[model samples]
Target: MLKDRNITLTVPAMPEYVDLVRLTLYGIASKMKFTFEDIEDMKVAVSEACNNAVLHAYDKDDGTIEVRFAFVKDELSITVRDYGSSFTIEENKETPAMHGKSIDEIQSGGLGLYLMQALMDRVEVEHGGGTAVTLTKKRQRTEEPA
Candidate 1:
């Protein structure tokens, strides 16, 4: 069995730095034999997490975002952490009803969480002094559709 491996990257909470996190994810996930489509999904999810930290976690540009990539038992878990602000997520509770609302009626926030949950196999958030969003994707050995 392959031993669990981890890679940690810390970047300034800026839009420009998000790409570096994606690049690092691509390298590690590719090495673990992730399919291109899956890798792309992961990249988008990770970017959203990093973007959230950059936009909401700090008052200015001094804060940093820490991304941790942990590979264990054929699963890749990526955690994006920010130490600036914190939020809460009550378990097993649905968000405010957005159903049947016009596109203009919906707000611009909280969509990143939805997007991240849709892309990854599992998404978890923890916050007290900071927020850490952990996105997990499991590796599968299957042929990609042509």
Candidate 2:
């Protein structure tokens, strides 16, 4: 069994709520002692994920986006999920990773996934009845002088 700090948030699938998600992550990143640059990167990645869910997830205004943040030793894992349409990977998969294709080649729409994979250490997209994007980033470890 694994024990870690976790936070979960759910909001209506609307563009207006994207910023709220960003701000929440910003606070969590800061609390976890992430550098300013890393926090900014997380904000961008999370906002993009949230925006995508809000824009493309549902046809009707009756869906919710669930975001969860898990903090483990030296790593933070973020998961964004939408109970709407599922996501499909583009065909031009040059690299093993979905984000391996160039921005132009991955013409599904938007630079969101690209940015998330670029900024985070690991990115994974899972589809079941809904779509979930998981982003993970490892924090820098400082050596204490003896």
Candidate 3:
């Protein structure tokens, strides 16, 4: 049953459009029985990803970000795709040295990336053909004594 539980959303890369992502995620996470804490974490992480796309993904307000979600037995996977420029975690880590800024200072500029990592169980980012950020989280399942 979980195999077919895939959800997707495509919204303009505008700050106002991100609310849809958050609301949809809340509904899905609630339906999946995630804890309140977990749902909140996911919402924050998802928003950060979307915000990044909106802030960096386009030279103008003419792009859209696509978010897709999939469910498995005990895992939720969400992928956010954008068709504009984006920087990776390593790029953020390296930016400090290139401009003689402290790593801490530069890293702070990438706070969204850090928050997403801290909240999600797994995060993978791809840069080609637009940026794709995939986040995964595991749900605790009560097991039957075998």
Candidate 4:
């Protein structure tokens, strides 16, 4: 059977809240039966998304960052939204290729997005006047012996 839960939270675009989000994710993912490693990965990915919203989206701290979490069946879905200019994923991927380059030579941002994508099962981004990132991860299953 499939189970679903949804939650939305608004946080000031500040760095401190990143830990709060990570803690919340740990609690939720733990309840959802995520392994310790999986929970850690989720925490990292969620933190990156929240940090991106705060740093890139609301750079001026003039707006709020919205985060939504949905747990369905063995999958957890997360959405982070911000009312700021959108970014292009393709444009960001170019940064990783500049190996051994100085910080100035390398792109300043979007590395988090790449890390999030690598950790999560799925990562989708929608851009407009606002940006939304949707992330999904499936729980691992174990069989019990009779």
Order by lDDT, highest first: 1, 3, 2, 4
List the lowest-lDDT window of 10 residues for candidate 1.
Answer: 87-96
**lDDT values of the candidates?**
0.90, 0.84, 0.86, 0.83
Question: What local lDDT score does residue 144 receive in model 4, on the 0 to 100 scale?
Answer: 81
The residue-level lDDT of candidate 3 at 124 comes to: 92
Model 2 RMSD in angstroms: 5.0
lDDT (10s digit) by residue, model 3, range 38-143: 9889999999999889988899999999999998877898899998986766777654343766666555446778789999999998989789999899987766
What local lDDT score does residue 53 receive in model 2, on the 0 to 100 scale?
A: 87
Predictions: Cα RMSD each: 3.5, 5.0, 3.8, 2.3
Candidate 1 structure quality by residue, lDDT tens digits, 1-146: 33497989999999999999999999999888888999999999999989989998999999999999999877999999999887665532446678999988887767788899999999999987789999999998787699
Candidate 1 vs candidate 4: the TM-score winner is 4
Q: How are the candidates ranked when ordered by TM-score, highest leading?
A: 4, 1, 3, 2
Clashes of 3: 0
Candidate 3: which stretches are off by over 4 Å? Answer: 1-3, 95-108, 142-146
The TM-score values for the models, in the order shown, are: 0.86, 0.82, 0.84, 0.88
Per-residue error (Å), model 2, residue 108: 9.8
Displacement of residue 104 (Cα, Å) in model 4 is: 8.2
Give a tens-digit lDDT track for model 2, residues 63-137. 999999999877888899998987677732433454567876655545678888899999999989789999999
Between which residue pairs do clashes occur in model 4? none
